[model samples]
Target: MASHLLLMRHAKSSWDDSGLSDHERPLNKRGRRASGLVARTLVARGYAPDVIWSSDAARTLETAKRLIRIIPGAQTVHHNPALYHASANTMLTIMQRESEPGGRLMIMAHNPGMAELYNLITGHYHRFPTGACAVFKRIGKAPWHDPQSWRVVDMVLPRDLEAE
Candidate 1:
């Protein structure tokens, strides 16, 4: 069976509070709604990530927590500091370190890294807008799946769900 992966960019964060550190920034009103939109979309599609790796930053943490509630099968979400502002290579390394083979994984993270990771996997460079979800199905052997071996099944953007 192919391993499923969802790359989620953190929801919109507040920039109004200059006093708050980037790590402490939380989701804005729009962000909260967007998060819920993504969650509902996942539930509607009957997709629940079995394992999750999320950035320790407040916004990502909130997104992960909120997103999982709609997934009946979702359990633990591993919050790691390294994921906060990880680079493309760093994110790839984190995925490689997973002990569970063929387990569906979800990563809630920040911009450039998320976009870079997606581009690395898809060979298509594009900025990941806030609240965007990129779904990938990895086919064939464990530790063997590369960019070419992965198929992008869906991409859900926050705006795409605005009509809902």
Candidate 2:
């Protein structure tokens, strides 16, 4: 069975705030608004997944919570420490390990890795801005692996949602 992966970057975060590490920063007002829009879009598009995985960072966790609130009764949300600042390969490894039989997965993470994963799977350059989302569909396989096996279905930036 083919599985789908929805990779989302956490919404905007506070950089002006003092005394907060990159991982400790929380989402700002715009970030919260963006997340709400993303969540509504996902719900409108029927993108709810069997699992919602996110980085342990404050911002990512908060984004995941907001998403879940919009998608009530969704599968449990997990905060994986390994996802914090993880590379594309690391994220892939996590996906490969966590995927269940005929299950769908969504990942809420930061940039660089999210962009890298999108690029790796789609074989195209993608600048995933904050609150951007890339949807991938695995073809002809069950377990998620090998970037070549996934195909990009859609890439939506926060601006795209705003435009709609």
Candidate 3:
């Protein structure tokens, strides 16, 4: 059996109010446009997740909510407070807790955690710019935690699909 995980970075956020805590900042216009494009691309490619886990922060939540609404087969998007600014290790722990073993799982989060998690999986640098998504597909029945069990499937960036 094979499984896949989509690790994504929250879309671009507004920094107009420096007073707002990192968690309170919201996505800007470009962010919304870019994330929307990414969402449609996921649905079109049939790589939408069965379940989505997103950080509780405003930016991440907005991104996840928008994406989930359009993900072809998606039905639920959960906000996990633990995922807010969660580190790569915390993300790994979350993956280990899943009840299912072989379905697409999407994590909406921030970087350097998103980039860090990608590095942990591939042992290479892959820029996770805002609204970026990378998928890791399992080659065998091995569990999600086993790094050797997976390989890169596909990667898409907002800039890649956005209309200039």
Q: Best candidate per lDDT, number?
A: 3
Please provide, for model 1 over 19-126, each residue's C-alpha lDDT reduced to its tens digit, 9 standing for 90 to 100.
999999999999999998898887787555776789999999998988887677787889999999898888877766756544577888998999998999888977
TM-score of 1: 0.92
Q: How far is candidate 2 from the true structure (C-alpha RMSD, Å)?
A: 1.7
User: What TM-score would every model get versus the actual structure?
Assistant: 0.92, 0.92, 0.91
Instruction: List ranges where model 1 is wrong by over 4 Å.
Output: 142-145
Q: Give the clashing pairs for model 3.
A: none
- Residue 149 lDDT, candidate 2, scale 0-100: 68
Per-model lDDT? 0.84, 0.82, 0.84
Poorest stretch of ten by lDDT in candidate 2: 95-104
Q: Which ten residues in a row have the lowest lDDT in candidate 3?
A: 94-103
What candidate 3 gets wrong by more than 4 Å, as runs, is none
- List of clashing residue pairs for candidate 2: none
Order of candidates by lDDT, top first?
A: 3, 1, 2
- Local accuracy of candidate 2 as per-residue lDDT tens digits, 1-164: 43777899999998878989998999999999999898888777766666788899999999888888888667778889999988899998986786453556788888789988888888789898999888778886544677876788877678888888
**Candidate 2 C-alpha error for residue 161, in Å:** 1.3
